[model samples]
Target: MSIIQQMNSKLANMIAAGEVVDRPASVVKELVENSIDAKATNIMIEVIDMGMGSIIVTDNGMGMDFLDAHLAFDRHATSKIMDESDLGHIMTLGFRGEALAAIASVSKVTLKTRQENTEGIEVIYHGGIFVKDGTSTLNQGTVVEISDLFYNTPARFKYIKSDLAERQAIIDIFDRLALAHPNIRLTLVMDNKTIKSTYGTNDFYSLIDQIYGSKMTNGMTIFEQTVQKIHITGYLLSPQIARSRKKDISVFVNGRYIKNYKLVQAVIDGYHSFMMVGKYPIALIHLEIDPSLLDVNVHPQKYEVKFVNESILAYYIETYVKEALLKQTHQIPETLKNISKGLDETYIPLNLNFGEAVISESKPVYETQNTEKTPKLPDLEFVGIFSGTYILFQNEEGLYLMDQHAAAERIRYEHYFNSLAHPNPAVKHLLFPHHLQLTSDDISVISNHPKKMNAVGFYFNEQNDLVGLPIWLNDSEVEIAIEAMVSMIVEKDAIDLAILRDKLAKDISCKGAIKANKALSLSEINSIVKNLRACENPYTCPHGRPTLIKLSHHDIERMFKRVV
Candidate 1:
């Protein structure tokens, strides 16, 4: 007898289950994809016993007949692909035909399906064995109930994550699928509570509003870019609305969700200089390309894909997203109709002397202190300050409110950043060499990186005390600046000179900028505004809070009911 023998069907199925049904989320993914492939307009997923106990997926789609339903549990039985040639051009979300079989092998499965013009049938399976069959009077759709996941395989069941973790995985998959298929009415319920739901409006903006909330609509813009037959379309959020994680960033290819780091990076790179450190913007990117140009069969779970023309895809995505962001900057945002309802502009308290303001029932106006305007200053005429924090101005385009502190920070950050980048540091000899005390770790870091200290214009004495300092910094500020750079290295526990220099610049700028509640004269405010306009990215501070907010005159009129 030959040493090698073919594995039995049950054994083969159990082996395949390792790939298809790793946890509750994997089973949900396979079944949901099957429903999507069946042309389902509406789908509902219900998780019970925190995902380890059971899962139910119901769909209003063209169901399978009795024979096809039975074969659905058999290995290598599929109606998606006919032969080998169909592999290159895969259109459906699922085609492997192993999901149902592999899933059934590990759990108790009950499937009830009724196709059009056919009687309904209910089939049950336990641990990959055909248990029984029954007749049912059901609608023309499918209902799949999977219970006791990993029951037959205790080893695999032990590796499953906690209930909360498993529930999160299921929610993640459901969100991805719902985002990918905005036209489908998707609902998800966990432990008797509906967790997620979307209408079948075929409008992605509406879907986003439903999921993230209506206020998020203010921070996002839609864009569509085409190259020949391929089309890239989606919504990209403003940098101000970015979050710390890339969790909100989603990518879809021809209505199928995928995980592609290069594509995600391309979207991030589009923000370029506008983004803050370690932050990612909200992006929902959809790419419509020829199915022949992509390979969706690369991954067992069908979440990863290989593209034939990824470079071209990345180029268009980066280019169009940048263009969209630029366009958004120039366009006026839609105004809320009742924005100024409770705000009384005419009321000026008796004790207040808010610079050069003439309050009237019609409209309030403020005169600028400087009659002669310079080119560097913005064309906007100066209005009074609001609460001593924001400087108000009016131009032909709109009403502008500049946060004094944030504006000054942007100007200061650029100044220090440029000086640090091009280190022509002017040094000053100390009248009395200051003795510096530091922790052993800081001393070791300084000792290891003598060149970094010299590059930042710090010269030490024989005892590692501060002897000389940068001329741009005052004697009083030297200790603070040096400590900032040293503490940054110590905190990170690393020695990247470039990052240390940048952090030092940012810290110095933030410390030196003017703070809120400090009274500023009209000329001082104008000077800050002029310097802010000269900055490369004046819209936001180094920490990414917007420096200014604009309210268009049209928006003001709408709020006052002057415009219908």
Candidate 2:
């Protein structure tokens, strides 16, 4: 007998399905792409049980006929692409015909479509095998329903997350799609509740205001630039309105949301000097270029793209955004002054509570000549604590409120990170081992890097389908920590040991740290300050939010009209 043989058709299709149908979110993405390709003016997505039980997508577009509906579930049967040359200049959202076929192989699928000139038809397929085919009386549109997702593959089904998490993923996908197509009215319903519904408006600014709040809209500056064959148009938020996370930045290329790090970095670099450290500004950027210049088939999910002239594109993006920001600085509108002025309003002092003031002007003595011997730590005197969360402090320059938890998280992250750099570090042993059940793929990935985990104070034992977790973690939080760590490792193949260690440490720290409502003693406040001063990057936390913000005496005086 031959050692090697061709796999069966069913097995081959299941393997392909593994690549495309990763979760309910993946199914939603494929169906939405098909709706966009069909030139749908209005799209609606409804899900039950967070899309694990059922997903229904209805669109008002030029629907397919009976023959086309049957061929849609066949591999390599796409109306978008016919010849090999068509791949070079692809304009449609989905070209490869693997979506429906791959999705059908893993779940029970029902497709109903009707064209303007033909009667409606319905087809049902289960596990890539046809179950029922017949004409159906329906409205003048297309509706595709997918149920029992990943049912055939028990291993994949086991990895489905909580309903809340899956719903979040679906919302994220819908947000991206809505941002790209502002003119297409879209409605998303989950478990009989309307999550999002948008009117088909051509006004981009109105759409931005709806998605992001008024704060983002107030800081937004419109920009449009065209260089050679490429056109760029979008909104860039002012540096003053910055966020601590990258979730606010949205970028779309030719109506497709992508995660190109190089492009995002280029845009950030353009706003270099205007933004404060650890702050990221919001952006809604759209880029248009010749279809042949970009390739979107690089990733299985189509979230990443490869460009032919990346260098040139990067340059144009940087230059255009930089110029736009520079020009806006000179265009601040002046308030119109009344010629016939009434009596000048008297200044009234509002009873403002300036929390605990620890550092009074009389506290510590410092001699300039003694600076040569040993640099003294700044005399950060405590003011008053605010809302039991922020620690108000005063120094020679200004008043600052320090977020104790954020500061502690940063300190722990740096310490844990530095410990990982050493050859031998302390590893706290668990008194009782914790068992974690994971998918086979996750187990394979974890097994491949046992040494890396050992370096970061984690030990695991694989037996059957469960992995034994370290005893250091509490029994309740062990699952969450493991899941987070596993997700991080899978997303970033080569795990930076330091980053992993810090992430784990931060996760542990946040849970045990004092909450905002908790009252603190004077000693506790002092301890927070001491720990913050020890941190390498004391200004920002691990999540990149400013730990402390300063308001100088000079600024106070200016605000009070005491100084120019």
Q: Estimate each model's TM-score.
A: 0.61, 0.64
Root-mean-square deviation of candidate 1: 19.5
Per-residue lDDT of model 2, residues 1-564, tens digit only: 779989886778889888887889989999999999999999999999989889999998888988889999987789999898998888888888889999999999999998897789999999999899999876777899999998999999999876545765787788788888999988889888776776779677666655553334654678888877778886887655444446556778899988877778777877764553344667777888788888888877788888888788878887777778767764322110110010122111111111122122222212222344532235689889674456788988988777665665565555444444554555555555555543232444456567656654557766422234443444544543554455556555445665666666555444333212235567656655554455556687777888888889998789998999
Q: For model 2, how big is the CA root-mean-square deviation?
A: 15.1
lDDT computed for candidate 2: 0.69
Give per-residue lDDT, candidate 1, residue 75: 91
lDDT of 1 by residue, 287-350 (tens): 8888888889987788899998788788788888877876776432221111111113321111
Q: Best candidate per lDDT, number?
A: 1
> TM-score of the candidate numbered 1?
0.61
Task: Point out the worst 10-residue segment of candidate 2 by lDDT.
Answer: 334-343
Q: Model 2: runs farther than 4 Å from truth?
A: 330-354, 360-564
Off by over 4 Å in 1: 330-564
lDDT of each: 0.73, 0.69
Q: After superposition, how far is residue 116 of candidate 1 from its true place, in Å?
A: 1.3
Clashing pairs in 1: none
